[model samples]
Target: MIVSIKADIFNNDKNSSDLSDLMHFFKKGRHRMNLRKIDDFSAFENSQWKQTLSRSDIDFLKEGMTIVDKKEIIVSESPSDSEFRIKEAYCYLQQPLSIVVENYEYEPVFINCIFRNFGNELITAKDRHWLKFENGGGASDNTIKGMIKELFNDTVFTKSKEKYLRCYIIKDSDREYCTINQDDTISIKKLPEAKFRFLKDMQIPYHILYKREKENYMPDSVYNNFLQTANKNDKKKEFSRIYLEFNAHQKDFFDIEKGFSHKGRLKNRKSLQADVQTLFEKLKDGKDLNDRQYTLIGSGLPFPNLKSDFSEKFNAVNRNDLEKRIEHQPLLRSEVNPADQNERNEFEHIINEIKYLL
Candidate 1:
């Protein structure tokens, strides 16, 4: 299946311009280099000064330029098991401040920087999943930074410049975001409005977002702190901030593994408790577990106490389904009638054990 990805773009930590323009940029004092505090671009170009340039900057410039215009990502595949890499565009907004660009949408939206609405509140897009990018129109007054200041410096912008904190996803044909309808348009459902804040600039796309607590998105200590906040409303805001900040620091580059894969984590562990009985029933009745159940529950429970507890619950499952895979003697996926076995699986004793702690 083809899924489109989108988001607003922010500019940050950029001093390494073209090889030829490096000296001119710094000699004018309009540029700043965070590359180990090296002040001169000419000095940066010197061979010995290579050490001062960030390896990340050099890696990004591998295409021989600083700017990346567009990229295609593989989102999913056909049921026949054929690979399907979805083509996604990262088109910069055309006259973004003056007009709307519709090629793609933004991801993990930064709230404070979204386009303005009538009351300067949340706005809508074509769908509930749409995001807003920072409007890049206002000029900065910090003349000391030169051209870069207007485009890149946040501190230079006057308080008069309006920064809208919300956006909408009604389709352009629906014409919901505009104050005066741009064309004769029809309005669909106006979706939920949300709040956001600016994200820190990072050069690569993110692998995950922390919309809520999950083992992959959060650590135990951080999650424990999140649990400490008493008010439910405040907790929601705090989580939104965490998601925004975490997403802001991520960048999605092309030609890499750039899609969601940890679906096994979404399994309902409590629901799986019933499946555990079916699993042992099949095993005790001379049946076996499938490859998915075995693979997802790899390496058994990490904690010994949890394993001991789980073992007590199912006497027949003392040996984990995962450990049955010997190098040569592979576990069978269809040794019995699949209809005879429980259809819903991918659950193992270890999976439920982890969930019990949460």
Candidate 2:
């Protein structure tokens, strides 16, 4: 977390001592400090506060603390003005800003949060499963709206009183794609436009997933494990078998939440049906159907049977196993993509954004 310091806090000897202690405390932890100017007071040598600090403290201020204009959680001595403030030394040391994820128990987001805040600590399987049972599902439109309303209320009514409270939201983009041309190139569309507007209007910081959702980012090993454990009679076992045969592009764009034939559940039902038909038409010439065409056609399943929730079930099982491994190791990057540079970069970008909020 980036802790911002008020320039006025260094105006006196007592405050200077507190600031020095705070700097040392922050240095020992992962948190970074930003020296901010308050009102007309400058934090530099030209200001009256420059005389309060000892030579070493001044040297540390230059070399150690990060100076930035942005404000996150503020550390202040005398109350001036700031939404999230740490007024005293005790509160500063004890309380860190909480990060609000879409679902706290979702392993992909939770593991990243844990990595940013606590580093790579080994978590027990029992505790991990407990988290999974507690709010592990994706947030609905209504749920996201309620969260946005709560954040607005907190910012308007509570934060005005200077009580320290800050939160960052991260959710999947839920983007979908379709084949755009004869070359099998795809065009992506970002879903849930209203939610993006709400977050922006509320001035809340957030990160959206580059892929469709958390399941799309799961490692190949997770799929293999799910296939190994699945019952031979299970429909999802068959679905997993077909899914593993897809190319990288098909896998990346596939909808894990609702398989290719979720017309009833999807808002763009007509467009989805059209895409399926278009892919089918392109491959109907009887020259062997490619991976992309096969994927879009519901893995060659009968139209009536395509509506089965096999994809959702397959996703759930793979996600659960991935969560177990993450709890024990917390190494998302290593498991996410070891060979693909683009995928690795995307994973790193998401993690760095989450860490910045911390």
Candidate 3:
């Protein structure tokens, strides 16, 4: 985080002692402290705090901070004033810097769209989202295409080049099913080419979901929990029953919102069936079926394909329950299949990339 130290600390001995402690803390290399080239230096020069510092401490302070002409500055106040002053400031350091284009500040993350309930829950989960940053480093759900178009605007793009806006993008791959190769590596049969191209050309870091969408990552526990509290309606009960019975592979790729059959979306059904059939055939000859294959076998032929029985009203209610469950338990790495060594840890990979931006 870029921080600006107030020279007013020189007026008080206690504030000066606090400032000294902060300077020592910065030397541990946890954050970057920057001072405005002219204004901040001039203030420091006129302040009496320097008189309290020895020659080595003065030199260390100078060496520790960087001088920049223009940068977002976190104004450092007296630590004694707030119990969590240091912690709060450190939290800000863990967020991506705001993109300042022509004096306008913008968020660093762009996503296709946020789920009305689930999206907010995932982004705002205390353990997942940055407390100091807006919506976890300010995610903009203007759609990937929309954000790319905005970035391509001549004036905005050209002006932004000087400041170099660092951004990360998260988009649903919308993959029907991922192919598990002979080597156990997973690959998407198809990707949204145009959107990927745009993001790649602009040099933005991005993560495309391995599954169909965020809802696919919800664990079985969430569905079961929802079932227990759900209204005693036949459709609701049926949906829960079918969902609970789904194999891990089916659960991972299933469209939670639309269910197995929505309209004539044959693509989802075909892909899922083909993937499962291939796996079933490959592992059936083995002495014992793996957990994945066992689940596949349990699903049975024709795959109990059903259109979502949820009414629009109940759908909203179910989604809210999803959000609540995820907020409480958080998405586990296992839920996204961290066992795929080729992919490694998908959740951690996304997190590490975001942390890099921060």
Candidate 4:
């Protein structure tokens, strides 16, 4: 199928990067917050590295059972006859790609979209949907939660909450609407402490503005107190205390960015520039990204097809590059531009490469 390709599909004037850089980049606070929540050995085990307990060890793994924990429940993985190997267990999570586009030929042809992966990050490999195809299609939160239930075989929730009230409704392909039975618009001023709590919980590394640009922002007094209790370090680390409003919009944006940030350190601007250069190179090279890598692109940025661009630009002749070359277009809202001349040059190089090959 020769799907119509256009320059506007991928072009963006607004600055946007992959979810890796935007969502989860500054999580010095999350690490600290997670540390405080480490009450048991299981808590100490990072969720990323948790061992898959044998099916028999947990009673919930029996075929077709829902494992309940507090208000949450674990439903088994969608029953499938597909392959399941220790090395490739995540290959089974594929469902038809559900996508939606506003207008194939028009201004804002590509709008912003969101994709929620069930905790099992590798599941998207099976198939993908074009956002333009569905009226309001995006990633399915219900599907993801169902997958999560199957993966964990047990749901974890706070003891106080009853009946799984925090369910998220899977809206179209990119947007997952939260159904927390609360007001639609959550404000920053209402939850003054949430911002500080979020920063402390995420442990993000960032520069802040204190006293209206008078001094570099440091952690607020509340954050300092939390750190004192959480860090337990006899010697203090360098603290940049600052007070800033982390309202709902900032929280939502940053939360997604934090989740999508690159795991490695981009210490300085020079280092960041180098990293960005390499990032474009990888995208142009059509690399087969694992779940984390793909998630970095989807969750971090405005473009869904960014990774596909890499695959198309790099592995055009390779048969496995089907998704990357053609099927990888995503419902993107904006495009990220390089901030400096050097960055722009690198970006333009990739764009030219796309023009030549794609």
Candidate whose lDDT is highest: 2
User: Candidate 3 lDDT (Cα, whole model)?
Assistant: 0.44
Instruction: Rank by TM-score, highest first.
Output: 2, 3, 4, 1
Write the residue-wise lDDT of candidate 2 on 233-252 in tens digits: 75555666666665444455
Q: For model 4, state the Cα shift of residue 268 in Å.
A: 4.6
**Residue 153's C-alpha lDDT in candidate 2?**
43
lDDT of 4 at 286: 48
TM-score for each of the candidates: 0.15, 0.56, 0.45, 0.16
**lDDT of every model, 2 decimals:** 0.23, 0.46, 0.44, 0.22
- Best candidate per TM-score, number? 2
Candidate 4 lands at a TM-score of: 0.16
Task: Give the range of the ten consecutive residues with the poorest summed lDDT in model 3.
Answer: 99-108
**Candidate 4 at 67: error in angstroms?**
36
- Please identify model 3 stretches exceeding 4 Å from their true place: 1-163, 180-187, 231-234, 264-344
Task: Tell me how far candidate 1 lies from the true structure as C-alpha RMSD in angstroms.
Answer: 24.2
- The number of clashing residue pairs in model 2 is 1
Supply candidate 2's per-residue lDDT for 82.
51
Per-residue alpha-carbon lDDT of candidate 4 for residues 1-358, written as tens digits (9 for 90 to 100): 0011112211222212321121121121110111111232233132222233333322221221121111111111222233122112211111122222222222011111111111111123112221112331222223333433544332232221212211111111121111122463322212234323422333321111111111111113323443455354422211111112222222122222222344632223233333232332222234433433433333332223433331122211222221122221222211111222332221122222211111
